[model samples]
Target: MLRLVTTSLCLYCQRAQVTPLLLTRPHSVIFQEENQLAVNALYDLSVDISKVRKLKGWVLRQSAVYVSETAALLRDMGASGPVIARVLELHPEAILCNPDQMEAQKKLWMSVCASQKDLVGIIEKFPASFFTSSSDHDNQKANIAFFQTLHLNKRIISKLMASAPHSFSRPVKQNEEMIQTLQKTYLDLGGKEDNMKIWLQKLLTQNPYVLLKLPNALHDNLAFLRNVGFTSDELLRLLSKLKGFVTELNPESMRLTLSYSEETLGCTDAELRQIVLQCPALLYYSVPILADRFKGLLAAGVSMEQIMETPTVLELTTQIVQYRIQKLRSFGYDVRSGSLEVLNGTKKDFEMSYGKLRLRQERPLFNPVAPLRTED
Candidate 1:
């Protein structure tokens, strides 16, 4: 019984702790009293209507307060008079309100409430529902898509437009053809994925100023640029540049010059012009470095197609260094310390050798033969 009272109080406290914003919005106040003291307090607060007969009569307003337990307390004769009825009207008493106890009585009802144990079960199920593992390849693809779909800017797209015209162009009739082209490019470049992504992203983010000049550049070019590693910063830069260009160039002239081209992969001559017009800063480091790197990688026994899918020179350099070290170790070379030193087997020979031992000859300590010769 004591446990029941405690649970009721806890539940009531939870309800009471709700923000007053939600509570005050209602027209009436409602409260439940389980304690004898609370009931007594309510009785003391009730008005004595018999003593206030001389008072000018006003229509008594009905109270909406209700109680679901301790209805017997309403008939306390030792306390205040008939005004108890008025208080009851304002604050009705409940016959029974212990929902927890009532629920235990109904065998047909399932447990309607979540207990701490049930919460644990829910939390346990969450891992099965929400957590999943994916391969590195899938993760990379997801990351690529994430960056592409992200709210990137026109500047980034414009830069991409300048370089990846084939990629930035209109949709092909067959996705297989597009995939084949990508694969061919990847193969041609010796499978350098990182280089391809970098170069493509460079074009996509060429210039924000140019992007404004060629509004459709980014929108059309994103698919191809995604193949390359386009970053959010590049996209933002492009958008900023595009906005600047929009302010500088005439809208109609911009439209006419950037008219769509099927061959340029849906990017317009105007877009290309816009890119070049605003190209000074963007082209300075990005475009040239990208082209040179791509070409260098391509020239060095890497196919252009393979270059599109393979790692960059820097990445490959590290991998190659590792591989070389592995090969050297496999071939019986001391990779940790590059050079080798040989030591003789005898104590004297080893002592005299440079590795693992050192020896200093002490002269005259062996003067036994000389002393004997002198004595003779």
Candidate 2:
């Protein structure tokens, strides 16, 4: 039995007129289990309930019982109120009270009410109307109460979110090591200054998805830095030199960057050509259609800038075919896949060797499969 050592009067035991157990002797009651390990199970907790001391006052005792029962029920329902409250009690300072937290709460509530009509009905019909008039302070309080009511077993969620405010406000430090590694590798490989920029751009474009995994504030800062030309070719060359010494790495990991230059600065044919001049490795093996488009555009007196912005000649031709296919499909006609290929092959031969596509009516051959026999 647990002993109470107190100078002040124990009100609970006073009401029951029962003596608070003193651990002077080694007398053991049924409450003191010989098999202490058995208490690990809930069934053990239930088995020993009879030996537990009852609280004074029927109303208070009944309320305590009901609360305990409800808490257990909520636990089984996967709702966690008591645990949330305990977590908050443990780290009251971490509780969100900022304007951003308030905004988040408002957004959460809005989304919940909008998507869940049943939740709306429950909120409206709940006996106390708990959610009806939630002021900012009340909202925060209610949020705490709601979490506490969920009966969460562990304080994992609370602990995880506890450091969020600090994390959100702080900027992540740039990895100088990665920058150095990139520089060393490229410079050691004899990559020219101009080539590094092209390499970086290519890396950024092909791996735009990297931005999503990055911490947002840091990513925004990096984007800003890039805009101001912080990621210059000179810096990249220096970093490339640093990369030569670093081993046991893919070397391309740090290359995963956002490709803002593609859409913003515009990766025109001229720019691509510049990259190719600096780094021949960057060139595609086959871009015949692209080359032809540029050639045609140039021949037609179209400026390189204009041609770059407009769809390529091959792309435009493909678009035309696609438009025709879509129109035909809309009119209850299905296109066979190989039909376009045959037409394209014919058109290619005609346009290059003979002439452009022209209307040519062809004589039909005698049908091998005759029309179905019609009888009156």
Q: What C-alpha lDDT values do all the predictions have?
A: 0.31, 0.32
Supply candidate 1's per-residue lDDT for 40.
42
The TM-scores of all predictions, comma-separated, are 0.15, 0.17
Error (Å) of candidate 1 at residue 120 is 32
The predictions' CA RMSDs to the true structure, in order, are 26.6, 20.9
lDDT of 2: 0.32
Show model 2 residue runs off by greater than 4 Å. 1-174, 208-376
lDDT (C-alpha) at residue 158 in model 2:
28
Q: lDDT tens string, model 1, 352-375?
A: 442232122222256555645455
Which portions of model 1 show Cα errors greater than 4 Å?
Answer: 1-20, 25-194, 200-376
Q: How well is each residue in 1-376 modelled by candidate 2, as lDDT tens digits?
A: 1111222321221334533333455674432222222222212223222232232112122111112222232244343454423322222111112223323433444332423333333322331121111233333344334333333222321221122222211222222233334444456446776666555434323432221233333333334433434344433442232222112222222222113223322575355433323322221222444445445534434454543333222334444445444544443334342122212324454244222212121234568798867898
